[model samples]
Target: MDLAARKYNFIQELSSIDENLLEKLELFLKTNQKDWFDELSIEEQKEIEIGLKQADNNELMTHTEVMNKFKKWH
Candidate 1:
């Protein structure tokens, strides 16, 4: 589906995958988080740290929100 159409469809909260993709993502997160975190370099660590800081401050949005931001722009 077109990304722009996804955005205005939900002004209050961002959009998400249509259940099936999210199920795959949930399984991926469950199985791969350790391998993923372990492979990150110092720079990627710093970026995640920044994101965590923003999240701590309630200044960060969900991954879906970030995707919405870029998918619309791009």
Candidate 2:
């Protein structure tokens, strides 16, 4: 039938399953595989890397400090 009916039927069938079947279902449900390996662009990736380095060096301040700095920037 429709998507909602199909999903509801799947959930009902899943709930009726034994513990072994549930375990197998759990693996399929928990797995997150994507088609793209590198989702971020080169620039975005570099920005993330730079942020990580800043954090490692303790150059990134606390939340309050960041808020104060952001207000100053404006």
Candidate 3:
């Protein structure tokens, strides 16, 4: 089929999906609309890479640790 016909068919098929599946698909598209890392500056990218490395090395804080640290202010 032609590109326009294919797109129309695809939209028709998508319209037949249940509401929950449609919502999930919309959420997935919105979340993945862009590669967030591509929009970051060089320094920000480096900081993210460093944070990821620390996470891989188990050099990260636990949820309880974070809560405890902030408990005083709350």
Candidate 4:
């Protein structure tokens, strides 16, 4: 089938789905999109990249190490 025909068929099939399923589909479509990184500021993006580089270099702290440090303050 042509793209237009396939789109129409898809819409037709989608319309017959249950309301709750349709709502869940809409939520999934909204939340699963790829535009979240574009919403971050340049500085925030740089900070995330730096943290990722640290992780790549195995420079991150473990949960126990972080908790131990935190315990010293209390």
Candidate 5:
């Protein structure tokens, strides 16, 4: 069968699958996919880690606050 037909058949088959099997398929796809974060530079990774830490510490600013702070520059 052609690729489009195969994908359509696979999606149709997915609709009949049980929740446990669906969860397994989801996990399988996630593990098999290439993560974009893995391509980031060390400095970029560290910056993300810092932002995550700040978030965990409740140090995040609201969208309006951030926009207001940077709006002067624009």
Candidate 6:
């Protein structure tokens, strides 16, 4: 189904839910609405920072180069 139709159906379902469920759903949505990066480990964040710095410095290799370099792993 399309997003609009799905949203309408979801709203219809939400209308039938009790106040307690609606409050819990609201809290769930609010608590879960964090940036994905904020959930990453410190090591992962450092690795991403390093990659971004390398990219900014134009220290990138081509897709073919990366695939060829790591081909043996597969």
Say which candidate scores most in lDDT.
Answer: 6
Listed in order, each prediction's TM-score against the native is: 0.35, 0.64, 0.48, 0.53, 0.49, 0.51
Runs with alpha carbons beyond 4 Å of true place in candidate 4: 1-34
Candidate numbers, best lDDT first, in rank order: 6, 5, 3, 4, 2, 1
lDDT of 3: 0.95
Q: 1-74, model 1: which lDDT tens digit per residue?
A: 57787666754232455778668867987987677766899899899999899888999677998898899678
Error of 2 at 39 (Å): 4.8
As a whole number from 0 to 100, the lDDT of residue 29 in candidate 5 is 96
Which residue segments of model 3 deviate by more than 4 Å?
A: 1-34
What tens digits encode model 6's per-residue C-alpha lDDT throughout 1-74?
99999999999999999999999999999998989898999999999999999999999999999999999999
Candidate 1's clash total is 0
* Residue 41 miss distance in model 5 (angstroms): 0.7
Model 1's lDDT to the true fold?
0.76
Error of 6 at 1 (Å): 30
Global CA lDDT computed for model 5: 0.97
Model 2 reaches what TM-score against the true structure? 0.64
Candidate 2: pairs in clash:
none
- Per residue, candidate 5 scores C-alpha lDDT tens digits across 3-57 of 9999999999999999999999999999999878988999999999999999999
For candidate 4, write residues 1-74 as lDDT tens digits: 99999999999999899999999999999998988778999999999999999999999999999999899788
Q: Is candidate 1 or candidate 2 better by TM-score?
A: 2
Q: Looking at model 2, which ten-residue stretch has the lowest summed lDDT?
A: 29-38
Q: Per-prediction RMSD in angstroms?
A: 17.9, 3.7, 9.9, 10.9, 5.1, 8.6
Of models 2 and 3, which has the larger TM-score? 2
Report how far off residue 44 is in candidate 1 (Å): 0.4
